[model samples]
Target: AQTVTQSQPEMSVQEAETVTLSCTYDTSESDYYLFWYKQPPSRQMILVIRQEAYKQQNATENRFSVNFQKAAKSFSLKISDSQLGDAAMYFCAYRDTYSGGGADGLTFGKGTHLIIQP
Candidate 1:
């Protein structure tokens, strides 16, 4: 079973600053996928970024980037030039490649609540 762990329960950052959210996972398989989803007060799950296990270079999207340490089983999200809109609950998720699309669902971490101070 693949599991994700988020050590931080909550975090706060000043507007226009930066923040980093920590996430770690345990998995036996090598080929898989990792994702970070953002849920705002509206309660919509938005795909923030994704990283393929086979890729050595971490994924970056605009102000968002990941520090993927495969050997350490750690994948962290770095939000630069943060804004008030960035305030939300961030969830780390994992998908197994060999699940055959059966009863397997995205395994998600407890989530980190990010609060932005304007």
Candidate 2:
């Protein structure tokens, strides 16, 4: 079984600035995928980025990137050039590829509320 944790309950950043959201996971399985999802006021879970455990390089998308510390089991999200639209609830999710349950094997953390200040 895997569990994800977000230590910070909330984070605030100014527009055009950069902010990093911390995430950590505990898992006995070696093959898995890490993901950062953003849920806005509309309640849509948007995929921000994803990182595969076997990959040595961290994943990046546009202004979003991840600092993946495999051995330490840490995956943090960095949002650069933040915008007002970036404000949302961010969740860290884990999917065990070895589980064979597909999307059903996903485990998520309690989200962190991100607030963008103008």
Candidate 3:
């Protein structure tokens, strides 16, 4: 079985500052994808960033970035220049390339609630 874990239940950052959210997962397979998704009040899951297992360089997008440590199985997210709109429940997810059985979709963590302070 595979499982994603977010150590922080809630996090806060001042506007224009930076924040890092911690995440870790357990998987026996080598080929997989890791992702970070943000869900605001509207309840839409938006993909922040994604990383392929074979990639050594981390993936980055605008103010969002990830530290993918394959050896330790840790994937952490860093949000720079935090904004009010960035406040949301962020979830870490994992997906394997080959699903021998059926596939539901992505396996997500409990989520870390992000609060941006003015």
Q: Write the per-residue lDDT of candidate 1 for residues 1-118, one digit (tens) a residue.
A: 8899999999999999999999999999998899999999899999999999999999999999999999999999999999988999999999877666564579999999999999
lDDT, candidate 2, equals 0.94
Choose 1 or 2, whichever is better by TM-score: 2
Pairs with backbone N, CA or C atoms under 3 Å apart (clashes), candidate 3 = none
Model 2 clash pairs are: none
Model 2 agreement with the true structure over 1-118: per-residue lDDT tens digits: 7889999999999999999999999999887899999999899999999999999999999999999999999999999999999999999999877545445556899999999999
Task: Estimate the TM-score for candidate 2.
Answer: 0.95
The sequence of per-residue lDDT tens digits that candidate 3 reaches over residues 1-118 is 9999999999999999999999999999998999999999999999999999999999999999999999999999999999999999999999988667775489999999999999
Which lDDT values do the candidates have, in the order given?
A: 0.95, 0.94, 0.96
TM-score of each: 0.94, 0.95, 0.95
**Which parts of model 3 have CA positions greater than 4 angstroms off?**
99-104
Ranking by TM-score: 2, 3, 1
